[model samples]
Target: MAVPSARLALLLCLMIPATVASSRSLRKSPANASRPTTFFEVDRPLRRSSGRCSTLLLSASFGSTFNKPPATNAYSPPRCLVKAGGRASAISLAVLEWRAACRGAQLDRVFGVWLGGAELLRGSTAAPPPNGIIWSVSKDVTKYASLLAAAGKPTFTVYLGNLVNTTLTGVYHANVTLHLYLRRTPPTKPPPATAPADLVVPVSRALPLDGGLWFPIQSAADVASKSVALPSNAYRAVLELYVSFHQDDELWYKNQPGYQNGPFREVTARVDGVLAGSVCPFPVIYPGGIYPLLWRPIAPIGSFNLPTYDIELTPFLGKLLDGKAHELAFAVTNAVGVWYVGANLHLWLDPGGTATTAGLVSYVAPAAKTTSSKSADPVDTHYHATANRLVSATGWVKSSYGNITTNSTRTFALVYLLTFETLDLTIVADTGVVATDGAGGVMYSAQTHGNFPLGWVYQQNSLTVTHGLEETTVAAGRWSSAPPYRSLRTTQSSLVEDEEGGGKSWGVRQTYRYNATDGCYFRNVTSSNYSVVSDHSNELCVKGAASVGVGAVTAALPTVNLP
Candidate 1:
């Protein structure tokens, strides 16, 4: 049957008029082919020429040619041209790739990539090829594709900084490639115009910490107060916070005795005194260093090169758009040192969507408390003989608009029980959500846990949801160790839908494991999205460790006080 169908199709093609076929072939020729094209290429040098200078101020600047290095200059890619009869949908996708090289040097610098004056990405120079390797990065810039295509010309810049200013001899170069996908046929409708967003306010500087006691810094207070107003038609809001610890800050106490690894401090973001989100930084050493030697990794990269916290401000969009003032605050509880922090608020106005504003009907901020007990100790021990600490936080959030309401409660706990041979660290978090529209409602529950030991960490997460007539549950666990550093992760999920007089169920389970010693990994998956079940497994190998980087560390010194 397949052969006959193929022959029939070929016969139909042969029956076409020669003129028609010739015209089609010409249109499909390489020169006329409508495919993805390189929009622009940019390369910039990092070092000065005349003579080797120990230190040169590498700041954010803008420029055109790549000949001379500028203190700070922005690069603008060529404007994207939409051909005649071409619509936004004609451009299927766009991507930007960045590549750089560094010579004989100590990689201990930080680089910031900016788009339209907003910091889009930042990372340390530690991971680029040691001395002979080329570093390359790629990202999907499709979200900004339409804007770029319509704009006359937009500027993009990369900022480089040597925090330590080590006297290393090396020349650094950066290159950027923009790829755009074009369609052969234009779409029926043109893309919508890009909406303007409020200017991002700088809340605080990346200040240094002395590592003494917990301090209060009102980085951003009343950001959306009467001074900043949201458009009347805005329907949604979001709060994005970028947080990072100085690499040197982490290295300062890396080898210190009695030091527990990872982000130990609790950082919280609040809107109008309502808890938005909280993060306890946990350091995980990448295989290479802070920047992975392998430029591209499987996991998604963050803008801060560190962990980032984001929260949906939809519930508060109403109040903010109400022509009133609102406050945005950040609090670092139990922080012993300084950490970098930045905040941005984004609002979305869709006249076609449900015309509604977000408002916090009720909320209970999370209360965090810490208690510790220790045995009498002098310099005799490494300050780890007998130590115990427990930290916990609990809170609830309730938001409403029109007749819809969402309520959620969250609780987090971290425990550290230490001994001479080992330090037992445990973290647990639980959250439950209920959204109601009149009597009908959806409910969700989740729990996560983490345990850390010498050169190793383990994590577990589970989620359950009840929506309409469907119920779903997902459970996952991951274990990672650095002794011979490796990782093993597993996930099991099930969904059941109640229909008529019976329920239909689907289940899926997957496992992935990687061994750094042998540079090998294994994956297995079993799924039953329908009535039938299926299973598959694969074993693969790679060049080196899955990821390369140093583990996260605290800035606090060993404690000698008892609580």
Candidate 2:
């Protein structure tokens, strides 16, 4: 029997006409009100010229890798680590530059990289155009310097859940490179400029596959946990978690009562057997979400670099630092379908002392207050709901540094308004959240806010819906500060989708800005029918761009205590 060639089996043919190319390097825009749009994402750029660097990581292509084992490689320090003077070259920083391209009909897939049993990064691929599309992402991994230079040779693993078949054929080609920056002259400071944790502990399983280490949460009872014998001198702790929803829970916020677990979901974490913190995860729209035409050269918010939640666990250290093994657990409330989750524990050890004594002074954690009411009228179905959660812990720790008292709080509220079986709406804001406070002053503080308002207008004939239109506005931001490390990132998108014309004729206008103590970035772009309409980007960062959107910032909601 002769098997059909994959290219012969054509899926939905997406005619992606190249307007120019997705780049600012090809056509530079003048600093004026009028601009020529380009295809690009609003990602922060790193100064590659800061020092001497080299690519010493893996570079390969992946296809038909679904359900099979992930690609693994043996890793060792590059030859550049040694100098001509017969001495070890001092490594100062690490950065990962990722580039990928794909064409033809295919679905969006998730990808990740792990080193020495710890995940370095996790992200999703973009839906490609017929003429092909290429995108790049740069991440600063300076904090993981110790792990990258650990003992002997460890395994480097790459996992991308992609499937190639006779019906859908799109082979993904990617280049994963690690650039190591060397230090000049000599070392002066006690700690590096990055101020990373003393040690990073992976809160994941040993399996290294697509969803290997990640726990699947389908219900409230399905909690993921691990036991660890942590360092006794650990004075500060934080959890950096990665999350992605699939199946029916993909658009969890838009779901309603009597259908797929309602419209509310909460993520919680604990130490030993005590509740530590909770949060309402962000509704990140993938590239192929809702309508694929809406995202072409530019993807939805946080697609390439998925946002990770940081939960301040310093107050709970009074229970964990007893120098014994303790259990760390994670769970989701009112979950449905599948939610893949995993985390890494970043611990800051007391530099002056080997051991520390700590005690919990006060703790307060209450159940979530929730309410919802649904009713149907002659023309439309009405639905409204709200959720609130609050948690706080205070403790005192005595070490060689001093007697430091720390308090952490987490609070968030959510309100939803919807009508018709074709539903929409969700909002979350920060009222007065003081994430972490020390004896001297506030060590770290962050107000995480999000408002994803959507509109659905369905056109039906008789008992069948003919076509529908979707308009979405995303107004979100994160304002955080830790002395010289203060920074703010925000963005807003105006999107419209037309299911007519065989699912064509779509457009989007977006604005993004990032400002911190170190750098600045600004971008505003427009797209129509999978092509660039207008684009203007600059290194000069601005403000108030993200505040312009369809909905107003709602009341406060439960937030993760960031330390």
Candidate 3:
């Protein structure tokens, strides 16, 4: 549908319209009823010159430039203007100059190339410094659209590309910056008066990298993990890069325009869409100006601690999205220190409808651990012991953010630590079918819940989730200080839960089975079966690893204390 032009001027201007092709195009404005009354001496196309700058001034005109406005509310224009399948006309590189005396004009065309994809810098570089090329073709036109009673119409979308690619490394100790601005035509008459106050859209929180958890160490270790959830809808993840860095503050960069303030956050991309970084503040170094560094990536772990931080990108996978099967690969710095890096397109979700999922990547202890040696000339000790018990754990928790009504899908990762000196660890879970009597009373499973599904167990330090069977065990001795380094591998298994016979009359409604040797075990379960014929019956199991120590420094000993 073609967007009308009449609604160009918004009531309380919040966002600038990228373009207004139709006479009734709807610009995001406040709900104040006002009309244009005065007529200005439409001056000759305003001529602006600043050396050989490539910025162009296009002609402005009135009357439906593309199509007519809607009849229902004669002023309402179409939501979109470009033909459903036609691409916008290509912008000319020549001296583009045009002028039209009118209320406003829709930006028909715009083209810009960053010196190094910088956002702030503009113009072409030859011998004269401030070298760069920027081309803009715009016309001030008006259009309008009817507002639905409940749902606000979606305005145009802004896609930021050509980012400076600064890697934000380290934990709470470095700074990052971003820049943003709206290109506008100097109004002929004084701009309209402002209302008492302006309504601003709250800035989105800075999303963390890899679901907010990075594991650079080869051995088993955990980091603090958290997530911000959104309702169930599509969104765009915006990233900001700064020009200067601040040594004192951990999250803020030196004063920079058009970027987000710190406190890193989770950025969401629109469902079934691709996000590419845009370059702002270009021309970091004039006359081939050096691109200012915006964000930096710093590794908090000591050089000897963990080789490379293992970032978890799993949480962002298969978010509420529909698309052909695709892999999500993150672009990260292979180097250890801070530097400028690029983020390439990784995954593409097609237009199919699928529920997006999110969960924890792993539980990490904030402070590092220290092992104390027993004796200076410690005697080599070796002992083997075995024991077993039942164990049960909850499925990964799903995360989300924003108002539930907005329908935004937030994703998170699930992770855990695994260590083995001489002993082993095992986990069991059951997959059971849920049964309900079409009312809001009791719920029962047809079979016992035991042995988590196959892909459920995260082996090799990486946690991947897939739909299917359940139950898995951590592999033994996958940890070495480096390579196989020190890690855990797990085997997963699953079973169906048997159901109870109608209301109260029941024997073993669900049966869980397990077999193990020499491993800590715990089980905590809470289940309820409510039937109209009887009061709700509840089954609760609370268990934990009975004897903690499985791996001791010199020999396998449960003598070591655990937190």
Candidate 4:
């Protein structure tokens, strides 16, 4: 069954315990941390605390639990630390446990957290586990510490929704704990002389559809600030985009054999109508007992966390920081269904700094595009399908600050190949009957089924400029499912290099391969000293090699107005 409305019921609860219990064992913590931390716990059933630091819990229940029909719930913390003034040292969001109810199966849910209407984090619920042990997931939210602390009566919301329909009724439990650590002494280097201002725009509530399927959704907003003129004398600027997708169980056209539905979807961001960067969405899967064991060892135990996509829009700051209203828009590509999105522009201004003189020099739209072809047998019986998709973009920026003038360009390209053949078959059965004193009978039946052989290959190459330097990254992945399409095997690899703007450069390359049969296993290889292979028994094994004087740096570099 497929869910028609595709909405889930969310229950918000606020919990404040006098003594917080630490679930640190469930996740790994970053090094270099002090003691004395504050914890806020959010769980099922609404609870209020007289304590100053309160916790909010978001829980989702479906089907039978909605005795009175479900509605959205909003919560606000009594006080936020960021508003207290001193700079924040660290912040993290730790998910203690996310487990599905006993009766629920075929689960597909999306979880999201928002502060003051701005999205902070979002992810998908993991498929139910066979053993029933709950799993934990964590993320570093240090970058958004300021936003969380400064929120005064801000709207904090958690949303949960189903992507597909299921027959069972159950509750989806989520426990999220927030950890905040503030600096007691301010003896270190003083915080930046000035902080960045946020300019936000509300995009579409639902992602738009294209070509009968959900294509990429795009929205643009004009930049404005109530406190100050837009982008006036800025040293640096960055744009943050919070994107969420509402996917259905029928992500791919099941009727179309050999076509992948969601695994390879990609999203890209742009500012001032110029290309910034692109990212591939991680596929979320909920496996049943019949699913291959190989994935069990390598996959996330009981949770599928959605990742927040962040792209550096600093390169376009030259044009954006002109002290004038500018348009900022984000575009998502290769997506299937409705998705939500929001944008925030952060600008760091220099004290006693001159207005920005950098501007767009020449721009070339990405040659990125997708094409497909299909062939039929001479007998007009069966058909074969093939598709080629190219993802590419290029941009040029030139800045004249003081007396130095530098020009730079960023280019990226990704190629995807898909090929598959569909099997054709026909069957007939007898079914008909009758009988009486001395009579007879008859019967008839007909049936048909098809099997598809499917394969997919993808490669990505990108060049980016950071702190006046150029960095290039390349990644590739390939996978194929055997005929009848019951399982999958995949191989993926990536390489990253930093150009020193000199004759020599350093980089690392890694490759991974996974097999479904033989109880699930993996082999991994890493680049090292031109030759030495390291062997291990891990699910993914690694081998190493290195290279010197491979090539010269060719990416153009840019000069900026700020340090």
Clashes of each: 22, 8, 157, 13
TM-score for predicted model 1 compared with the true structure:
0.51
RMSD of each: 22.5, 9.1, 31.1, 23.1
Give the C-alpha lDDT of model 4.
0.32
Best-performing candidate as measured by TM-score = 2
Off by over 4 Å in 1: 1-96, 127-130, 139-154, 163-166, 178-228, 251-263, 272-274, 284-305, 324-327, 353-355, 375-404, 407-411, 417-563
For all candidates in order, the CA lDDT equals: 0.36, 0.61, 0.18, 0.32
Error of 1 at 56 (Å): 25
Candidate no. 2 TM-score: 0.79
What TM-score does each of the candidates earn?
0.51, 0.79, 0.18, 0.49
The top-ranked prediction according to lDDT is 2
Q: Residue 326 deviation, candidate 4, in Å? A: 4.0
Tens digits of per-residue lDDT for model 4, 1-563: 10011110100010100101111111112212222111111111112222133254355554432113222345433234444343432222212223333234435455555555455555554444332224344554545544554534544445554433455443455555454444344233322311223233223222121111112242212221111235556533444555455443222221133333322334555554545555433222322211211122123222244434444444455566656666555555544445445544455444345565444333333434433334453332222222222222212222221211222222222222222211111111111111111111111111111111122111121111100001111111111111111111222111112223421111112222322222223434322211213322234322221111112122333322321
Candidate 3 lDDT trough over 10 residues, lowest sum: 292-301
For residues 1-563, write the lDDT of model 3, one tens digit per residue. Answer: 00012211220121111101111211122211233211111111212232122321112222231122111111111222111111111111112222212122111111111111111111111111111111112221110001100022322111111111133111111011111111133222221111000111111212122110111211112111112233222221212222211111111111111112211111111112322111111101111111100000000111001011111122233242333433222221111112122111112111122233433222211211111112222232222211112111111212222111111111121111111111111123221211122232212211222221211122221111111112222212211111111111122111111123311111001122222232222221111211111112222222332221222111121221111
lDDT of 2: 0.61
Tens digits of per-residue lDDT for model 1 on 1-563? 01123332442232111111111111111111222211111111122222221211122222122222323344433333344233334454455555555544444344555454344444544332222334555555444433434433334555454322344444556665565555556555432112222223223322122221112233222122213455655544445565554433342112222233222455676656655666554432322232221112111122214334444455455456666656676765433333455555655444354344455554444345555444455322222221122222222222222244444333455555432222344444333333344554422212222322211111111111100111111221111111223333332222212223332222223344444443444554433321113444444654554454223111122321111
Off by over 4 Å in 3: 1-82, 85-228, 231-354, 360-563
**lDDT, candidate 2, 1-563, per-residue tens:** 00012211211133111111121112222212233222345666665466555764777677888766777788776565544221222556678777887766677777777777667787778876555567777777766655666647778777787888986688878888888776665343323112566677888766555544566787767988889877888776777787878777877776665556777888888887788878777667677765565466577776676667677777677788867889989898888758878888887677677887777776777789989887656455577778888777767767765666665666667777665423445545332223233445533333434444443332221001011112222312121212232234444333332233443344455665655444566677766555666878787744543343333222333333323
Q: At residue 23, what lDDT does model 1 achieve?
A: 16
Clashing pairs in 2: 37-534, 37-535, 411-557, 411-558, 412-557, 412-558, 413-557, 413-558
* lDDT accuracy of residue 454 in candidate 1: 18
* RMSD after Cα superposition, model 1: 22.5
